[model samples]
Target: MKSSESTNTGLVVGKFWPPHRGHQLLLETAAAQVAELVVLVYANPAGPGPAADRLPAATRAQWIRELYRGDELAQGPRIGTTPLRVFALSAEGDGVPPDAAPDDVHREFVRQWLARQGIAVATVFSSEAYGPGFAQHLGAAHVSVDAARRHVPVSGTLVRKNPLATAAYLHPLVAAQLGVVPPAAIPRVVLLGAESSGKSTLCAALAEACHTAWVPEYGRTLHEQKNGNLAYEDLLYIARRHAELEDEAAHKARKVLFCDTNAATTALYSYYYFHRCDPALQAMAAVCGQRYAHTFVCAPTVPFEQDGWRGPEALRSFQHGMILMQLDFYRIPYVLVEGSVAERVAQVRRALGMVDDA
Candidate 1:
């Protein structure tokens, strides 16, 4: 039966620790049967048991919202007209019954919680065999979807063991959060150096050689746009937009993405000019090291070019030193690239374990 007890809403509940397409199938199926659906995600914020492996409750809830209610899963185009309400029910410190508790006990626990929340439901949707019994306990109809997993052919264990291998069965948002790089996930190779250290030239050449995509320094473009007159606040905007540009290029990237510079380098310049750094920009710089698959520090060994907006050759050297210091402070590993653009390209290729022309 698709639905019953039209006066009451429908309910679907699960840990949704690492939700897969199977969960989506259940949700869509449930929504089809009711005027409204409420998904209650459960997880233990503090645990030493099976729930310890579960993603945080808030995180799981966010994943559900992102999949069904946000962006790509935006309203009106989905399977059902029923609005879905999603929230996390903390298993810890909430008097919720343990998973091992008897069915009667667990059902009572859910009943009390629902009563407290003032939520009434007539249908309990699930993929598990417990659906019918659970629903009967709540005086609701049981609408089971794919109990054999025939439609989805995937499980939480299978998805967790090898997320990358089973990405097709998982949403892009879930795969990303679980650290499973999407097929379209481009490896970002970030180059850090002083101005006129050949980062831009090398970035373009490497992208061409690899037949991929490259992101030019947005910071420099923004600097020029502001006529080289920047304030402390401008640094945050530059760092943010620079990252956004890189992300935009990543979608069209063939195998990898080459970035001329990163947010940390932006922070260096920010501190250099204004002696201050916005907290948000600082946070971006702090995690910037982890964002790149490879880091290349362009050496100032090549003669510095005299761009109209550039500082003296001495300033270039000082900035190079500062960049290196920042890398060491953050313990970010990087390969040093010097000489002509072609030579640097070859060096990068060698770092990637490809044959390079020395």
Candidate 2:
């Protein structure tokens, strides 16, 4: 291994299992010393990682580009205007055998591949101990960056064990892929009832009282957009949009997420207005039941307003009864929210154990 001053062109190769900040620093260090830098990503096909956990080679290459692209969100130091190139070595083209050991076998394959590309490697940058032999074999100087792992202390293994704990060492996109919810998991509280049952008002009040985020009724948003000219096909879309918004809000929720409605409401409306509900809406409704930890069924006791959007007041009781039946069919636990806005909030907070009954 030699110092960085003797290098004109640098090469780096690693599995980049998740491309944590340590990998970012190694690439940044190489770019600082060399006129040009090339990064190669290699993940053994026979590795122990689950197929779903293994990110595609192309995706890792894109991560390299994004990390060094000089954006504020990009991790590690800015590369300024350094010429950087990323490559994913194909198992067939690069002659990387599935059973070959990572020691000399992988090093020789890398040397041959670099030589084939007419890349005269002046320096090989790495944080691993194999850097010296790999660089010497390629007739290039080895520039070891952070051998003690001080600068950006992290590893791919450390990340996989507890992703949410070490999330600060990962790129946003990479962290998201690992299913790391940045915020703590929160209980999703859904409000359910017939239209004009004060479900929306209750949802907002609960969100404010709990000091957390809330998902508004997407069905209402779509209704206002279409001037209440909704169709049977719109039920599924509204159900899907409601779930998407709920998921987005979950990441930002404090301890709980207040939702105006769930897919059960969508399925109920579909059967009520169209005389029959679609099978897909039924499945989504079932899935929604499993998502919310708690639900509050608003009682239809208030005066029914003759809104331009709602149906006849005569159907109010029937709608309310249908919601109860659907809730029971789905086996979703819910408390009946009755009385004024303050009373309803108090009931929900008590049901969710957000406050003591005293």
Candidate 3:
């Protein structure tokens, strides 16, 4: 028989290492039977064990809120009226001893902790078999939801073991935190160099060779759209767009995302045209170097072709030196890609440890 559910307030407690669909189901089921539902998310800031794998506690609590708050819960008509209260319990140096098993000692500490918060739980919900004993300790009836994991067919253990494999079972927000790269794991390669240094050509060739997605230079788009009249303010916008495009391409990449130009190159241009880089552009440049798994610095072996929009062709080598210095300053590792397009592509492939199937 199902346990008593006629209660004013109910609670569902869990570590929520990475909140999954199973947790969502348990919460929705509990909220359906109670007027108010208090979700006590147990977060271990110190990272309890290998099971946790250093997933942030605050992020997990936020995931619970994201899953249960307002319209998110409205889909379930029963959960709509139930006022959900989300709270965090730091499992590190908290109520119960760390070594204590999930028994009366742990349940009693949680019961007392809830009591101290002026919340008198009349029903307790959980997926574990020990829910009844835990509820009894708090003088509340236990409402077991998916005790056999038949409903959701997913668990924290499965998720922790391989988040990317079980990405479908996790909320978008939680999955993002666990490094579950949507689509697949793809190495991002940014081709950073001076103007007319074959960066665009090399990026396209690499993308084609690797059979991956590529992000074209956003600055070129902006320059074309604005008729080449670029202001200092536009530099930051270019940097921001570069990052956005990289993120977008990463989702579609097969094994690598090739970027024609990155934020560092944008910052260099800012200084080249405006005599200085904006603080915002500098910040973008600072972070841009790390965004790519690998960067290829194009050597100015090919003659600089002034495309009407470019600066003095004479400054190509100087600009190449500046790009190299910037990479050094950021401590970003990069390979100098010179010679022909085929040679540059081969160099990048060797660095990435890709066997030439061709």
Best of the candidates, lDDT: 1
What stretches of model 2 exceed 4 Å from their correct place? 1-184, 356-358
Deviating ranges (above 4 Å) for candidate 3 = 1-185
Model 3: pairs clashing at backbone N, Cα or C within 3 Å: none
> Model 3, 1-358: lDDT tens per residue?
2235544799998778778889988988888788888887764333455635444565567656644433222333235567778876666545433534657777878878987889999899999988999999999989899999987898887887788888767654455456553332466778877789888888888878888889999999888877888877677667665665676777888877888887778888888789898654565577554456788898998777888888787788898899889889989888998888899889888988875734
lDDT agreement of model 3 with the native = 0.74
On lDDT, the stronger of 2 and 3 is: 2
lDDT of each: 0.76, 0.75, 0.74
Tens-place lDDT per residue, model 1, 142-261, is 888999999999887787677778876765446545555335366889988888899888988988888888999987887787788776766766666676677689988877789989
- Output the number of the TM-score-best candidate: 1
**Minimal lDDT window, size 10, model 2:** 69-78
Quote the positional error of residue 66 for candidate 2 in Å: 30
Location of the lowest summed lDDT over 10 successive residues in candidate 3 = 69-78
Candidate 1's TM-score: 0.53
Where in model 1 is the C-alpha error above 4 Å? 1-10, 18-37, 43-85, 91-93, 136-146, 150-154, 157-205, 213-293, 298-332, 338-347, 350-358
Tens-place lDDT digits, model 2, residues 151-267: 878887787677778876865445545654233257788888887899988888878888889999998888888787777767766775576577688889888899898877888
Error of 3 at 77 (Å): 37
